[model samples]
Target: MAGSAHGDIPLTTISFSQRPNGTVATVTVSNPRKLNSLNTTVLDAFLSCVPPLAQRSDLRCVIVTGGLCSVGQQAFIGGADISEMKDFSNAEAGRTFINKLHLACKALRNLPVPVIARVNGHALGGGLVVMASADLRIATSDARFGMPEVQRGVPSTIEAAMLPAQIGAARARRLLLLGDTISAQEAESWGLVDKVVQADQLDEAVEEWVDRLLKNGPRALRIQKKLFAMWEQVPLREAIEAGVWEFGTPFEAEGFEAEGRRMMNEFQMQNRQRKSRL
Candidate 1:
């Protein structure tokens, strides 16, 4: 695990760690005592981690996992800290918090590599948003997923917006409006989580998925990620134009041209050898 400390942030609510897995990096969130609630400190620490990650050519995938320290063998994160809500009496304070939250989510979404959520336990409220923002989500059978914000007297702002896009609008409302928690299995059924594994098998499941991702050509994955980010904003032709330039421009650049060509040649050679044997 690797990270530079961010001691300047006043809130001690978030901790960061970087664990290298071949070409993939795993950034863990360990604030179990606080149910992994995100405050200003946590957001700052996360923001500090993003830029360096984006610049790494070796990175192919990323996984974000939550810490579990609460009662029962359940949940990755219970929810955000309601106590922190006491300070937001006016619109300005609420707007500031929301903006920070939006930027942090955007940073995760904009990551050059695919980001997976390894949901070890319960993920609720803002924790759920983090999971949703990830490109893929894998949860343990015992894990519970939900947005209990309504129960705490607040609307599910960011999550409400993304959840509908992930699952259908109806299923998203069923969970958000009712504030009901669902098992990992049910979440997977509704497309909230991509997969659910036995508790003991969670780590292995995550590794297998990462292995599959790394097997693909890196440039292909990066191009796919760029297109995905643009799909919602631009028309088909414009999005294609944007993605082609976003992806192709880098290839013509000095270092990328050589490395990418070499990798493609190697991949073709491997395919040819395998086909010959077959």
Candidate 2:
């Protein structure tokens, strides 16, 4: 993983492989050779990759990152290849482009299990939007994030409906209105990212995150995750009522309390056994 200066930018490409454990799927945005720009071809490849991997019951987490040697030199995705946009003219063309972008984002959002963005480098403009679709995101200290579409004479389209909820109005406005890049640390502060670690430590950190996530029961995690998602659309009171009726009432009236009692008793018995062994 040498630095990008050694004619490695074209090495910027995307690939996905499942780990031997079959629990985590790793998607690499290579082209540490080209900085992994998301042109139409790359986007099509990425969209194709996401669906099948997402359907796997064996998968608990997905780790997305850049190729080795990808550091401060280039972004995880630089942006849509500007050269590819030369033919855009009519409203229909613009709508089609935006539709593709929206579907790509939606695919990630709709993934049943968690997706972790192991951002290995800069993620600007459309790149940042792509990163934002992940459920959890860990950025390296050298990672850069922004939405500089305005700088390119384009409006921030797909994110027009999503960012405000994740980051709140003020922070979203600052990023979207200005179309500026922010340090990984700053992104964490604004609630756009989870944490920033040393560049060399990103892979280990992502694995650690997945380890923690795997400790939870899959069904419980799915229910709770959807619970949080439902909170966004309905009003607070209505959400609370719906949660009480749909989730809380069923669980509370079901085996949860009994399970808690049983678990506590089992834990006490285990403690006694350990003491006797001592």
| Candidate closest to the true structure, highest TM-score | 1
lDDT of 1 by residue, 16-109 (tens): 3333433777776655456666776666666777546788877888888765554445556566656676689998887788677777677778
Q: Write the per-residue lDDT of candidate 2 for residues 1-278, one digit (tens) a residue.
A: 11123455343223444545347776655554446766555566567777676667777767776555344484566666566665788878777777776776777777777889888788877778878888899988988888777878878878556789888888788777898788988999988889899978987998888888776555445556666667877899988887676554324434545433444567899999999999
For each candidate, what is the lDDT?
A: 0.75, 0.70
TM-score of 2: 0.79
Question: Which portions of model 1 miss their true places by more than 4 Å?
Answer: 1-22, 240-268
Each candidate structure's TM-score, on Cα atoms with residue i matched to residue i, is: 0.82, 0.79
